[model samples]
Target chain A: MKRKIEFATIVEAVKKCCIEGTKVLPQDVYLKLEEAEKNETNSLAKDFLRQCILNADIARNEAMPICQDTGFAVYFIEIGQDVEIIGGTLTEAINEGTRQGYKEGYLRKSIVTDPLFERKNTRDNTPAVIHYDLIAGDKLKITFAPKGGGSENMSGVKMLKPSDGRAGVVDFVVNTVVNASGNPCPPTIVGVGIGGTFEKCAFLAKKALLRKVGEKNPNPLYAELEEEILNKINQSQVGPQGLGGDTTALAVHIEYYPCHIASMPLAVNLNCHAARHYEVEL
Target chain B: METKIIKLTTPLTADKVQSLKAGDRVAISGVIYTGRDAAHKRLVTALDENRELPCNLQDAIIYFVGPCPAKPNTPIGSAGPTTSGRMDAYSPRLIRDCQLRGMIGKGNRSQAVVDAMTQYGCVYFAATGGAGALIAKSIKKAEIIAYEDLGAEAIYRLEVEDFPAVVAIDSSGKSLYK
Candidate 1:
């Protein structure tokens, strides 16, 4: 027998996740900021890191958003083969939830109806970006990560010859971030996606940001790569808010996929220190 | 070395901000205006077409921000600075034309913007990036005065008190970024 999941349940879950995610900075990110502050040598950068912590606390306590740029809603969802969604379409349910969450939570409605020409506000944040996956169990899981424009604008994708190898990847990632400086709101959490096609590489880079701040990649080689890239980035003196210090980045996460032998593709996505994500499983 | 937190009040004049230098922290008070990407485009367009702007921008500080809606009983919500680079194309013109005294936002600016600041006796300040909720406490009032249709990108008159920022570029063309 297939498991029946109510559409309202998913809507409510997404609604709560959107509000909570925007309001509260995740524990892992908060702790990492604390650690960064302790390790920072520059007094100004250290004070800025402390302010980030205080800012998060104020948001959490007051039941308000941590930043004005509440971000574009992006969802990663998984559905079991034996599960059925009833009463409405999954996409509609999520969009409805987003509309309610952003309105009720006092989050900014950032989406403009059209990107280029007549950039009109949607008023209600709707038509969220969603990715779906099929899994074996009788369960449904949804993860919401709000992506702010500042950090997203600084993200990039690059195609490299296989001959360029690890050296090329490191150089590209470091330069892209260091060059951005304070524009993306350092110290940032960097997400690097390697291999795959152009679109898949972009997706992987964003998905990599969902992982815990300190969690290393399961693969030994990628784990080592994460540390190396992170060290090189921190040495650039970007620091907190790019004013200069020892804590330019909290973590560097790399997710990889097998691709055609002919090309190497790389994507780099950056999340501001406010790094907010929340999820639910049912 | 010790750093000083310079105090400032709005409706700023060139003489008032002349002493500001790169690396100095500032606590700004009184009135300032808020305008971001779209609002800037409109403001600059008005200047280009030789039309009058809705608000008086002379000797003003324009903060680059779009705040979250206020919760009941509060004057404003998480009001933080956005990336300043996006406003580059419009800033030099505003600086020279309006006699803009100071600008508050995050990120390094262009060479043209720096050059304008040097010539026009203006300063650029960078707020604590991503510190939105905390910054809101400094904003005492906010009322949309122009381009209300732009929603968050609307131009608003804000009354701020001790609004904190750091001097990113000074009148002498000194910059904190490499």
Candidate 2:
């Protein structure tokens, strides 16, 4: 017999996800902030890093958003085949929960109705970007990430020759961040996607950002590669706000998938220290 | 750190500017109006129309922000600096036409804005971008000054005390980023 999960439970879970996601700022990000503070060489940059930590603390205490950008809400939902949701549709519940969380949490309403003309505010932050996938269990898992535009603006993807290999990937990512400079709010988390098709590579790169900082790839070779990329990125000396210093990037995470024999695609997504994401399983 | 409150109507002198550096903490008292992209566009359009501005811009520091709606019993919600670059195009016009002296926001400014700062002896200050609630504590009061139709984007006359900020760009053409 299939187990039925109440729609209220799903809505409550999503609301909790949004609240926890905005307030906590993630353990990986916290570790990265501490690391960036230690590694920052420029005095101004060091102070800025310290302020970022303090900002996190204040946000936690106040139960408010850590950044003014509150960000565009995006969710990745893994739904089980055996579980049935009652009362309302999943999309309706999620959007309703988003509106409630943004209104109740005092987060900013960043969405506008029309991007081109009549740029009227939607009033409430709504219509989240939801990606759903089906899995084989009775459990429902969801991850909500509030992606700010600064780092989102700096993300890039490319389809290179298989012969170009790892060197090509490194050069592309480093060049992207170096060019970005202080725009994305430095000491960023670099997410690299390799091997998948063009769109898949981009998707994987964003998903890779959700991984914990300092956590190594399961594959030893990939783990070593991540370390190398992290070191090389710091050497750029872009520092915080592009003032030129020792620490430019906090961590480099790479996630890969098998690609076609002839195709080699790479994508890179840069996330600022405000990288806010949280997950819940119901 | 010692705190002092300066009213907005008082003209900012060179001595006042010199007293503050890239990292000095300050609390602005009295009336200071807020304006961002949409309101700025309308203000500039009014100037182009050869009409007077909604509020006097002489010696004023325009804050580039669109704060969240005020919750009940609260003056304002999570008010913080938005990215300053988005307002770069509209800022030079405001500075030149309206005699605006200072700006408060985050990130870097264009060379043209820097040039205007030097020519007009203006300054650009950086408020803590993400520390909205902590920053809000310094603001004792807030009222809608103009552009009420813009919703949260409306112009607000805020009265603040000990609002912490760093001078990102000074009158000497020196940038904090450099």
Candidate 3:
């Protein structure tokens, strides 16, 4: 029997998630910040990390957004095979929730109606980017991640010859962070996607960011690479806010997929220290 | 490295700007105007038409910010600096044509902007980029002064007290960007 779910139920849950997502820092992120603060050596960088931790607390307690640029509302949803929607399309429900959440939460509407020429504000920050997948259970899971342009704009993709190998991927990732410097708000979390087609690689890179901070990749080799990349980034001395210190990145998360034998595609996505996100199970 | 701690009032004089150096910590008090991309274009267009600016620019500090709306009782919501590179094209003109003396934002400025700062006796300050909630505490008042249609991007006159920032570029053309 198909379990019927009302569209309104999804909207309310999504709305709550959107509001809470921007207002509160996830536990994993908070823990990472605290750990980074304790391990940070430079006095100034340590102080900046402390400020960020305190800022997160104030935002959470006040029910205010962690950052002014409330960001593009991106959702990852998993729908159970046994569930059937009753009232409206899933996309519309998510968008309605985004509109109310951004407006009610008093978050900034950063979306422009057009990319070029006559760029105009969308007002309520609608048309959320929603990605969906089907699963076996009878429940629904939704994760809301508000991605700020400061870090989003810094993301990059590079296509290399298959022969370039692991060294090539490392160089590309490090160079992207180096070029970004303090612009993306340093002590960033790096998400890397290797293999796949051009667009798939980019998607994988962003999806990698949804992983819990400091959580190792399931593959031992990938987990080792994550640690190596993290070490290399911290050694760059970009520090907190790129002022030159020991902690340039908190963690490096990588996801890979097999690609055509001829091409090796790599993508890098960065999330700032705030890294606000929340999840809901319905 | 010894960093200077400065307490500066608004409508800063040339001497005040010259006294600042790269890496100094400043707590600024007094009135400042907020303008991002849209408001900046409008200001420059007005100048091209030989029209008066909405706010006086003499020794003025323009904060490159677009803040969220205020909640009940609060003067402003989470407010932080946007990337300074976005305003580079208009900043040199604002400095030369409007006597703008200071700017507050994050990241590096264009070479033209750095040169303009030295030529016009101005300084650039960088606020903590993502600490919007903490920064809002210093802002006591916020009112839209022009381009209200721009919504969050409208020009705002803000009354700030001890607003914290770091001097990223001094009047001598030296910058912290490199």
Candidate 4:
């Protein structure tokens, strides 16, 4: 049976998610900050972590964006095979929801009409970077993340020779994140994507960011890789804002897929301390 | 926090600029101007054409930020520092031509800019990145004075009180990053 879903329902939910996503830091990420503060020994670096905690509190209690760079509104939609749309197309509804939410929620519009030439503000933070997946079920899942430009600018995708192996992947990921230093806003969540093709690996890296901070990969081998990366990053002493401390990164999450026989593709996407992502299933 | 926090105000004086050291926590009060990549681009363009800046740059502090629009009854929203590296291409010229005294933003600066700061007696301060909402509380008033069409990237004049920051680079070319 096809489950009928109203276009308005999705619009309203997207609007709410846009506001809720940027206004409130997820509990898992918030708790991780608290833990980082407790574990960090450098007084100055610990203070930066404290400010992060306090900033989230102010943003939530005052109904303000956690950061001024409300960022590019990104949406990940999963549509079940057994679902039917009642009013309009899914893309149109999502964009409308984004427009209304950014306007009503007082979120900043960061999107440009053109990337190279005019670079005029779109006025509404619309035409979101939407990704869709078709799945089997009668439900729809909407996931939203407000990705800051500073962090997003630091993303990397590299094609490596298969023989480069585990050691090579680890080195590239660490180098990219560490070289980024304070620019990505440290105590960041490192998202690693291994395998897949060029663009596919980058997408995988971004998708990996939606995972809860400190959540382990389902595969135990990959989980061990995550732990190893996390320890190495923290030891870099890049600290909060790359100013120096023991809390450079709170967690590292790795997502992988089988790829071409000869090529090993790797992508790293770093999410700042204000890692905000929210999802709803209907 | 056992560290002694310094309290400073602007338009800053030469003596005051020289007193700061890397890693010193500062609470800045008084007037400052905001700009980001676009505004910096324009300002440098104006200088190239031998035109006056929208505001006098002498002894002025330029904060690299693109703030969220203010809410009802609020001066500004979620105003935080952006990475300063993008401004590297234009900063040395501003320092040499206008005696630009200080800058507030996140991330390390380029060598040429640091050399200019050392040559011209300026300082670089860093705000906690991503702490926008907390930082907005310090901005008492904000008004767009130039390039309104640029929206967030437009230059804004702000009245601030006890704005929190740390010295990332000092007048002598000393830095926190190294």
For every model shown, what is its TM-score relative to the native structure?
0.98, 0.89, 0.97, 0.99
DockQ winner between candidates 1 and 3: 1
Alpha-carbon deviation at B38 in model 2, angstroms: 3.0
Clashing pairs in model 2?
Answer: B27-B162
- A1-282 per-residue lDDT for model 2 (tens digits): 677888888888888887778877776688778877886767766767887788788778877677767778889999999988889988988888888888777777777788889988787778888889999989889899888776788899999899988898888988888887766777788898998799999988888888887677899988998998888888888776565567778888999999999988999998887888988898
Which candidate should be chosen as best, given DockQ against the real structure? 1
Clashing residue pair totals per candidate (backbone < 3 A): 0, 1, 0, 0
Expressed as tens digits, the lDDT of each residue in A236-264 for candidate 1 is 99888888899888999999999888989
What's the residue-level lDDT of A103 in candidate 2? 79
DockQ of each: 0.87, 0.45, 0.69, 0.86
Per-residue lDDT of A1-282 in model 3, one digit per residue for the tens? Answer: 998889999889988987888888888989998999999988767877887888898888887788888889999999999988889988888998899888888888888888897778889887798889999988899999999888898999999998888889888999898778878887899999999999989999999999999889999999999998888888888887777678889989999999998999999999998898889988
